[model samples]
Target: MIESWRWYGDLDPISLSEVAQTGARGIVTALHEIPYGEVWPSDTIVARKAQVTEAGFDWLVVESLPVHEHIKRGDGDLSELFANYRQSMANLAANGVHTICYNFMPLLDWTRTDLEAPVAGGATCLRFEAVRMAAFEVHMLGRRAAEGDYSPDVLTKAAAWFQRASEADRDALLASIMAGMPGAFDRYDVAGLRVALAAYEGIDRDALRQNYKRFLDEVVPTAEDLGMRLCVHPDDPPRDILGLPRIVSDGDDLAWVLAAHDSPANGITLCSGSLGANPINDVPAIAAQVADRIHFAHLRNVTKDPDGSFEEAAHLEGDTDMVALVKVLLDEQSRRRAEGRADHTIPFRPDHGHHMLSDLGRDMIPGYPLIGRLRGLAELRGVISALSHG
Candidate 1:
C-alpha cells in the first residue's frame, strides 16, 4: 500500500513540512478553493502539484472534487455542470493526478454531533449520537417530517434531551450540527438548511441513486479516457440523516455503484471508519470482496453503540479489525502484482484521529489535529510492516 496523508493546501494549519515528518510520501488533497460546479483551472492544479512536489510528496489522490448540489438533485440546466466536472477531470489528469475521490451525498459532507467529544486519556474524538442528531432535527431545525424519521424511543429520548438542554447547550448543538465542513460554517444557517432540505423533498433513496448513476454515466467515460480513476466515498454514517436520502452506505450500495459504470476507472474509496459505523457492515469482508475495485482507502475505526451512536476509536482498537483489513488489502496488492497491473499498490490514509498529546489544546480542524493523525499513521504503518513480513 502507498501510505498517504490528506493535506488541505496552504491554509491548513498543518504544513507540508510537518506532513513529511509523518513519513507519508503521498499527499491526498483537493483544490478546496475552487467552488463546487466550477472547473479547476489547469494552472491551479499545476501550482498545487508544485507545492506538494516541492515538499517531497507526490500528489497521489484528489480527496474530492466536490459534486455540485444541483447535480445531485438533478435540478436545473445540468449540462454546464456536467461539462465543468468533465473538464475538471481532464485538467486533473493533464496534471498527472489520476485518482480522484468524491462523494454524492446531498447538501452536507460528513457530519458529527460533537466535534470534541471527550474520550479516555483526556483526548477528544469526533462523535455522532443518534438521539442528539434527532434532537437537532426535530426540536432545533424543526423539520416538518423529522419526527417520522426516528423511532418512538429515539423521539422520546430526543424530546427529553431537547427539553433538558439549556440555551447554551441548544446553541452549541445547533452550531455543531449546522456546521457544514471546515471553513463552510458561513454557508449554512437554519434558514439555508431548511431550504436545502426542502429541495430534496421528493427525492428519496431510489431517486438519489438514479441521480448518482446519471453522474457516473456522464463522467466515468471521461475518467477512463484520461487514464484516471474516479472513486466514490461511502456515506459518513452509512445511513440516512437530516431527512435526506443516503444512497452509498453499505456493501450493496457499493456493488450497485461499481455496476453502474463497470470500468476500472470507476471505483470506490474504501472508507472503513465510515462503513464500520453501521455494525452490519463487515469491514474486512467488504475490503476483500471489493479488493480490485478499491482505488483508495481511509483506514480508521469507530466504536458503535446499540442505539446508533458512535465515537472515533484508536485505529487498532475500534470495532473493525484493522490488522485483518490491512492483511486483505495487502493480499489484493500481491494479486495485482502477479496480474502485472501497473496500479497495484493501493493508496490509503489514517483518517480522523483523536486529538491527543499536544493536539489537545490546539484550535485545529475537528478531527484533523497534527499529532493525532501522526500517531494513527505510525500505528497503521506498523501494522502494514508486521503483516507484510509475518
Candidate 2:
C-alpha cells in the first residue's frame, strides 16, 4: 500500500507542501475546475501534477471525476456524456495517473448534519444525525410526504424533532443538510430541492441499480481500453435517504456489481470509513475477497448509530479493526507478487480525520484536519511496518 493524503487542488486551505510534510508520498485530488460533464483536458492534468510534484508529492489518485447527472438518470445526451468521461480517463492515464476513486451516490455528496460534533477529547468530528436530516426533508425543505421515506417510528420521532426546533435551528439544519449536494442545493432554491427529492421517490433501489449498470456498461469497456482503473466509492451512510435510492451499500450490493461486470477497469474503492458505518459489513472479508480487483482504498473508521447516524472516529479507535485490514491488503499484495502479477500494489489514502488540537479554529474540509490525519498516518505506518517485520 502506498501512503497518500486527499488534497483538494488549489482551493484547499492546506497547501501541497504541508501535505508532503505529513510523510505521505502520494496526493489524491481532482480537477474541481472542470464542470461535471466536461472532459478533463491533458494540460489541466499536467498542471495539477506539476503543482503537487513540485511541492514534493506524487499525484497518485484521482479522488473523483464526478459521474454526470445526465448519465445517472440515463437522461439527456448520455452517449456524449459517457464519451467525455472516457476521454477524461484517457487523459489521466496518458499523464501516468492510473487509479481513480469516484462514487455513484444520488442527489448529494456525503451528508453531515453537524460539522462540529465535539468528541470527548475536544476534537470536533463530522456527524450524521437522522433526525436533523428528517427535519430538513419534512419541515425545512417541505418535501411532499417526506415522512414516507422513514419508518412509522422515525416519522413520529422526526415530527417531534421538527416541532422542537426554533427558527434559527431549523435554518442552520437546512444549511447543513442542503448546502451542496449535486442538483439539490448548489443551484436550486428551497422549492427546487423539494422537486428534486420528489423525482427520485418512485425510483426504487432495484431501478436505480439498473441505471447504474447502464452507466457501467457504457463506461467500463472504454476505461479498460484506455488502460485506466475506475474504483467506484461506496455510498456514504449506506442506506436510502431523502427518497434517493442507495445501491452501493452492503456486501450483496458490491457482489452484484462485480458479478455484473467482470472487468479489471470496473473495480471498487473499498472505503472502510464509509462501508464501516454499517456494522453488518465484514470489512476485511470484503477486502480480501476482492483484493485482486481492488484498485484503491480509503482507510478510516466510524462510530455507527442505530438510527442510521454516525461520526468519524480515531483511526484505530472506531468499530473497524484497521490494523487487520491493512494486513489483509499486504497479504493480498504478497500473493500477487508471488504470482508475478503486474500492478500488485494498491493505492490507499487516509480517509477522513478528526479536527483535533489547534486545528479547531482553522478553516478546512470537515474531518480533514491536519494533526489528526498526520497522527493517523503515523500510527498506520508503524502498524504495517511492525506487522511485516514480525
Candidate 3:
C-alpha cells in the first residue's frame, strides 16, 4: 500500500509542507478551481503537479474529477460535458497523473446530519443521525414522498425528533446537509435542493444505474487509451437519502458497476467509512473481493447504531476490522507484485478525521484537520509495518 494524504490545494489550512511531515509521500488532490464540466488544461495539471513535487510529495491521485450533474441526469447536451471529461483525462495522463477518483451520486455528494458531533474523547467528528436526517427530509425539505421512504417507526421517531429540535438544531442540520464538499459544484439551498431532487423525479435506482453505465461506455475507453484509471467512489451512507437513488452503496452495487465496464481502467475507490455506515457491508470481505479492481482506498471507521445512525470513530476503534482489512490489502499488494503490474501498490489516504488537539476550533475544512489525520496515518503506517514484517 502507498500511504497518501488528501490536500485541498491553495486554501487548505494545512499546508503541503505539513503533509510531508506525516510520513505520507503521495498527495491525493484535484484542480478544484476549475468549474465542473470544464476542461482541466494540461498546464494547470502540470502546475499543480509541480507544486506537489516541489513540496517533496508525489501527486498520486485525483480524489475526484467531479462528474457533472448534466451527465448524471443524462440531460442537456451531454456531448460537450463528456468531451470535456475525456479531454481532462487526456491532460491528466499527459502530465503523468493516471489515477482519477470520481462519484456518480446525483444531487449531493455525501449526506451528513452533523459536521461537528461531540464524541467521547472530547473531540468532534462527523456524524449521520438517521432521525435528524429524516427530520430534514420529511419536515424541513418537505419532500412529498419522503414519508414513504421511511418505515412507520422511523417516521414516528423522526417526527418526534423534529418536534423536539430547537431552531438552532434545525439550522445546524440544514447547514451540514447543504454545505458543499471539496471539489463539488452542487451545494444547495432549501429550494435548490428541492429542484435538484425534481431533476431525478422519474429516475429510480435502475434508471440511475443505466445512466451511469452510459457514462462509463462513453468515458472508459478514453481513460484506457490515455493509460488513466478511473475509480468510482461508493455512495456515502450507502443508502437512499431524500428519495435520491443510491446505485453504488454495497458490494452488489459495486459488482453491477464493475460488470458495466469490465476493464482495469474502470475501477472502484474503496471507502471503508462510507460503506461501513451500513452494517451489512463487510469491509474486509469487500476489500478482498474487489482487490483486483481497487485503484484507491479511503481507510476510516465508524460506530454504527441499530437505528441507521453512525458516528466516525477512530481508525482502529470502529465496527470495521482494520487489521483484517490491512492484511487483505497487503496480500493484494503481494499478488500485484507477483503479476508485475505497474499499479500493484494501491494508493490510500486516511479519509476523514476528528477535529481534536490543535485542530479544535480552527475553522478548518470539516472532517479535514491536520493533527487528527496525522494521528490516523501514523496508526495505519504502524499496523502496515508490523503486519508486513511479522
Candidate 4:
C-alpha cells in the first residue's frame, strides 16, 4: 500500500509540510472550495497539484468529487450536472490525478452522533450511537415514519435517550451528523432538514439503488474514456438513517455495483470504518472480494457495541483484524505487481484517528488531528512491513 493522508485544502490546520513529516508521500484531497456539482477549473487542479508537488508529496487520490443532490435524487436537470462532472473528470485527468473517490449517501456524508466521545487512555474519538441517531430523527428532525423503522425496544430506548439529552448535547449531535453540509442538507436548520427529508419521502431502497446504477451507467464510461478510476465510497454506518435508503453497505451491495458497469474504472474506495460500523460486515472478507477493483482505501478500525453504537478505535485494536486485512492487501499488491499493472500499489490513508497527544484542545478537524493520525500511520506501517516480509 502507498501510504497517504487527507488534506482539506488551505483551511486545514495540518499543513502539507506537516503531512510530509508523518512519512505520507501521497496526499488524498479534494476541492472543498468548489461547491457541489460545479466544474472544477483546470487551473485550480493544476495549482493544487503544484502545491502538493512543492511539499514533496504526490496528490495520489481525490478523496471525493461529489455527486450532487440533483443526480442522487433522480430529480432536476441531470444532463447539465453530468456534463459538469464529466468535465471535472477530464480536468483531473489532464492534471495527472487519476483515482477519484466519491459516495452516494443522500443528505449527509459519513455521519456520527458524537465528535468527541471520551475513550480509554484519556483520548477522544468519533462515535455513532444508533439510539442517539434515532433520537435525532424522531425528536430532533421529526422525520415522519422514522419511529416505524426502529424496533419497539430501540424506539423505547431512543425516546429515553432523547429525554435525557441536554440542549448542548442536542446541538452537538446535529452538527456532527451535518458535517460538510452536503447540498441537500446545507442549511443545517430544522426546516432545511425537513425539506431535505421530504425530497426523499417516496424514494425507497430499490429506487435509490436504481438511481445509483443510473449514475454509474452515465459516469463510468467517461471515467474510462479519461483513464480514471471512479471509486464509490461505502455508506457510513452501512444502514438506513433518518428513514433514508443506503444501498452500499455490504459485499452484496458492492457486487451489484461492480456488475453494473463491469469495468475496472468502476471501483470502490473500501473504507473499513464506514463498513465496519455494522458488526455484520466482515472487513477482511469484503477486502478479498473487492481487492481487484479497489482503487483507494480508508483503513481505520471501530469498536462496536451491542446497542449499535461504535467508536473509532486505534488502527490495530478494534473489531477489524488489521493484520489479516493488510495481508490480503499485500497479496493483492503482489498479484498486481505480477500483472504489471501501474496502479498495483494501492493508495490508502490512516482514516479517522483519535484526538490525542498535542492535538488535544486544538481546533482541528474531528478525526484528523495531526499527532493521532501520525500514530495510526506508524502503527499501520509496522503491520504492513511485518506482513509483507513474513
TM-score of each: 0.97, 0.94, 0.97, 0.97
State the C-alpha lDDT per candidate. 0.89, 0.82, 0.88, 0.88
Give Cα distance to truth, residue 281, candidate 3, Å. Answer: 0.9
**lDDT tens per residue, model 2, 1-390:** 789999878768898778878889889999986778889999999999999888888888898989886666656568788888888988999999988888888878787888888899788888888777777778777765667766667667888988988988776666666643642226555677777766665677777788889888987887888788888899887877777778888888888887778898889899998889877898888887777778888889898877777899988989889988999989988998998978888878778788988788899876688888998898888888988998
Predicted model with the maximum lDDT: 1
Candidate 3, 371: how far from true, in Å? 1.1
- List model 1 lDDT by residue over 1-390, tens digit each: 999999889768898998989999899999888778889999999999999999999999998999888889999789999999999999999999999999988877888899889988899999998899999998888875878877889889999999999998887876777654523323566677787678888999899988999999999999989999999999988888898888888888899999988999899899999999988999999988888999999999999998889999999999999999999999999999999998999999999899998878777877788988898999999999999999
**lDDT of predicted model 3:** 0.88
What would you estimate as the lDDT of candidate 1? 0.89
Residue-pair clash count for candidate 2: 0
Q: Which stretches of candidate 2 lie over 4 Å from their true place?
A: 144-154, 179-189
lDDT for model 2, on a 0 to 1 scale? Answer: 0.82
Q: Candidate 1, which segments miss by more than 4 Å at Cα?
A: 182-186
Residue-pair clashes per prediction, in order, are 0, 0, 0, 0
Q: How does candidate 1 fare on TM-score?
A: 0.97
- For 1-390, candidate 4 gives per-residue lDDT tens digits of 999999988869889888888999899988888889899999999999999999999999997899988788899669999999999999999999999999999887877888889988899999888788889888888875788777777788989988998998888888888873653326567778888788997899998988889999989999999999999999987888877899999999999999988999999998988888877899899999999999888999999988778899999999999888888889999999999987799999999898987799798987899998999999999999888789
